[model samples]
Target: MSAVSPRPSYAAVLRIPHARRTFAAALTARLSYGVVPIAVMLCVTRATGSYAVAGVVLAVFGATVVFLSPYRAALVDRYGPRRVLLPMALLYAVLLCTLTVAGRHPGASGLLLGVIAAVTGACAPPLGPTMRTVWRELAEDRLLLQRAYSLDGVAEELLFVTGPLLVGVLVGFTAPAVGVVLGAMLMGVGTPAFVMSPAVGAMRGSGGVRKGRRASLRPGRELLPPIVVAGGVGLSLSAVDLLVVAFAGQRRLGDDTVAWVLAALSAGSAVGGLLNGAVDWRTPARVRLPFLAAGLGVTLGVAGLAPGVVTLTGAAACAGLFVAPALTTAYLIADEAAPAGFRTQAGAWVNTSVNAGSSAGAATMGLLVERLPLGVCFLVAGGVSVGAAVIAGI
Candidate 1:
């Protein structure tokens, strides 16, 4: 048999000099994501004594991000990420501070709190896209970029996991508002550094995208597939989230067991993303993407039908294995497909679709979970994933 392609070396990847700083800053910025919603929930509950009100406040933040991501990204493409990133990062902190301070007072109205949360999210810096842009700028070649994307995907998974844990620590040791406060601090420090890094500066100075290109909802003439596919991934994830909680409740798993089970799913994705990155693929990303999307849906369906936590975990892992590979490919494709100067906007559009899809999927799957068996909820997620595959193929 032919010897397997050599594993991509992480040491080599990190040796590029600019990589470490960008990675550090990107990870730092990501940590805040975990803290914000939970902190907002906690802060709101503390002040209003109503989980319902807190949930609404959090939802407003999510909705605002979905709509505003593309515009913010367009600005980054126009003026360079620093011009966009620095100001937004600072504003994000200020908004968080406003919300935090307002949350402390009984006189703060829900409308005021919700408005603050919305603005904070709407003006949030395009750090996620900016980092992806950095990777594209820094990677030596397509293969290296593939490795970078895979590494980035895995790191993101870890960030999501760690972020919540950090917030938990803060909430336990200090106060709920402290979590949001810390998240804001992370953004304030991390985003500016990330945007100002040498790799980012090189990207801005390269003048790849035209200075005056008009922003559009269109990622590019060619980017619609990846955008839709990303949306589907988001849709399935939200459904799986709800299903996992329902499964834990149905099985009478302890309060904390749900967290573990969810963590297992994410753990599987992280492992899969790392492994995928190490390989040299023979398949074109476009062909592989649909298969992976379809596979995730099927695996998730099977997992939903599983009878025990062990089986469910196995199934979840199988599905998770497909996620990063598909996402990495999509991001690569987006880079290729984006109109010149619209790189940031292209990433933002993909993000916007995913967030929008998530909101829709969560709301839709939520209604189904109320009426259907928990196993069927997995099937629903699978159906959504399959639809996403169809979009990818289209």
Candidate 2:
């Protein structure tokens, strides 16, 4: 008689010795990323008393973070996270504190703030990619690895949502600089805890630096599909935010109504992420990725045709369903394609693609909304995603 294989579960992923501890510590550090953005923006705005300066400062920060991400990840790959992460986190935390102190007084120099923000961005640790690399090491079984990625993705989504809300609550009582200080504390405390984990300790003995130095820096052709699809997914999702706002405005709905619609999108993504992880699919991840991207594209296109807010919310929810699964699959593919000693950098490329695409999408959609019909803008955004999928398939 054939033996029945154990079904892969999230509990099983955590049950792997050290996984729970390591993941928890990583999440603690990652939460700082979610908190820092809004906190920094608010602090800058308060200091400069000009939204224009605040916007430029935030843009400089984001540009550095997004563009330098892969290089940061490469450092982790070469030096190993245990040896590298703590120092990076410390520098990052110190910079945040410095920024807080400098931006506390009104009429703070915008140029100085921009310089500090840029330096802070450059020093930001690649904790997310490093954690994903640790996950790859812990979950040797393919199915279990899928679950780990899905759970990580869902938790990350929640962190970003909660981080902004947390900042909102804190600013009601304290200054915005306090929120920035809070983020610094999280990073200062969390990185040491993460690096001390036994899982990370194991990596220290592997001589990743020597191996990483020998590995080619350029990503191979196999990585193209995931990277391209990830960029497309980011572009479409970013554009959806503006499109929804416009959709609400055209119908005379208030900003509160727009929140509810966006809430549906988040709800759908969380549910879809959980479901994607739970299933034991026969199809390979590479085979599954393009189809997932296409599903998102079609749903987003249909969202443009919604006659009412309710229908639009439903369409957005449908689009959200594909968001997590597609990105998760993209990460999985990138991991598979990565060379030995290069896993962190491989993951960072996918991450950088998503963020860079988001910046572009937001700018493009802003212009399109002024000149084109809302429905047409949606079509253009969706079409970008579909085109990416087609390119990946070919």
Over the full model, what C-alpha lDDT does candidate 1 score relative to the true structure?
0.81
TM-score of 1: 0.95
Give the per-residue lDDT of model 2 (tens digit) for 226-299.
Answer: 99999999999889999999988888999988898988898889999988998887888888888999998989
Cα displacement (angstroms), candidate 2, residue 366, comes to 0.4
Put down candidate 1 lDDT per residue, 355-388, tens digits, no spaces: 7878888899889998998888898898887888
Over 4 Å off, model 1:
1-4, 205-212
In angstroms, the error of model 2 at 40 is 0.8
Highest lDDT: give the candidate number: 2
Looking at candidate 1, the ten consecutive residues that score lowest on lDDT are 205-214
Task: List lDDT for all candidates, in order.
Answer: 0.81, 0.89
Q: Which regions of candidate 2 fall more than 4 Å away from where they truly are?
A: 1-6, 205-216
* Lowest lDDT block of 10, candidate 2: 204-213
TM-score of 2: 0.96
